[model samples]
Target: MAFNGKFELESQENFEELMKSLGLSDEVIEKYKDQGKIIEIAQNGNTFQARYNYGSKVITNDLPFGQESEFVSFTGHRVKALAKLEGENKLVITMEGLTAAMELSGDKMIETLTNGVSTVKKIWKRI
Candidate 1:
């Protein structure tokens, strides 16, 4: 089970930090300031969908969805980076292209996050 809600920070500093933590450069933030359009839509009047928008475009994970690596790992098309809530704020981080088990009952979402980033770094060769 996962708790899905819209998480936004109320501080300028923390808000910038949140974007930075998600891998956006300072300049990028400035350009996209107030340009980030996130929407949490409802499905079947019972489920929610969280998505980020830039201008008129929507960002997505592009990970492949398969059963083999579905649990205990994060991967696939339509797969996206992860956003987590830390000590005092909500953070958006790249899913690192890893698909780990959905930690439904854990506050330490970063644990699963690291796996994706680590795997991405290790498997990709610099060209």
Candidate 2:
């Protein structure tokens, strides 16, 4: 599967700004600012399992394309989301107030998260 890999965070943009706009406390934001993050993805057919490792926390989501599923947001809230595959290398997930798109290019995966008010882009390298 194109999305199957263990990726380590390389760099990020607007992460703090987005978190701040989302009402996250400065202490919470600081806690995760320099945290090492890793994402492991396994895709089988149209179904995918994604594991996100953020130093002290690990969140996993089981997603089936075109179906609504329960997903945990970065804010640690459960939300109903629909996952969709765009072409062959991109997976887009839409939740109540957020949209996340993960696109694979070469050995890197670029994840863009938007909450209407702010946007964050994180680049990950396959490890």
Candidate 3:
């Protein structure tokens, strides 16, 4: 259950809706939908760091299990998040009004995000 790899987005469901619900501007959503994003993650023991890159812009987060820390949302908002490992390959994160889970199975990574109002699914492939 090693979470050290570069992942590229393969498909997204309700991405625009989720971005809009998260207060992202229409222009930003349009650009994101067209370009997509890449994520690189590294995990060491109980510590995790993830880098998200979209063209020239990049965001990084370092998360420790079960601890509250500041993390940047997709919309660039600094939010509080608590992350914990579920079993071997699933990483569950809870933020203010939102919950996200990322699971690595075989060669794919499946991520789900929910914020009460809407749910978004993002599928990624290892690179």
Candidate 4:
């Protein structure tokens, strides 16, 4: 899939539950509860870069496909993630204990995050 555009958050499912499962504090949860994020994905060959805003912070992750990359998680933990393309339209990223499966269909991007037990679905629309 060619993920080279900007996407705005359309909807998110089980957000609070997913945050709780990730061991986020109540205070932290309440702080960013209603805040939505906009993400920009830029891909060139096997190199990938994704930029997103978290609160007042702008986080960017740059990595290569099929390689291990370290990034700071939202919960303030350092974690490793391996990103790869699955088929023609799916982008899969495997993190510590979680997997993010992203698919681009038309002008919408659907991302499903699974942490073994709990799963959260987030949808973003092209901007």
> Model 3, range 62-114, lDDT digits (tens) per residue?
98888999999655789999999999899999998889999998889999998
Q: What are the per-model numbers of colliding residue pairs?
A: 19, 0, 0, 0
Tell me the tens digit of each residue's lDDT in model 4 across 1-127.
4678999989999877877887778899887766656889998778788887777877788878999998666545778999999887898889987898989899999999988778889999999
Taking all chains together, each candidate's TM-score versus the true structure is 0.33, 0.91, 0.90, 0.91
Relative to the unseen true structure, what is the C-alpha lDDT of residue 48 in candidate 4, on a scale of 0 to 100?
80
> What stretches of model 4 exceed 4 Å from their correct place?
none
Per-residue accuracy of model 2 over 1-127 as CA lDDT, tens digit each: 7888899999999999988987889998998787748889998777889988877788898989899999986557899999998998999999877899999999999999999999999999999
lDDT of 1 by residue, 28-91 (tens): 7677555533332222222223444555766433222221211111111343344333333223
Candidate closest to the true structure, highest lDDT: 2
Relative to the true structure, candidate 3 reaches a TM of 0.90
Better of 1 and 4 by TM-score: 4
Angstrom error of the Cα, residue 29, model 4: value is 1.9
Root-mean-square deviation (CA) per prediction: 11.9, 1.5, 1.5, 1.5
Q: Model 3 Cα displacement at 100 (Å)?
A: 1.3
Residue 77 CA displacement from its true place in model 1, Å: 12
Error of 1 at 96 (Å): 4.0
Off by over 4 Å in 3: none
Instruction: Look at candidate 4 and tell me the lDDT of residue 1.
Output: 46
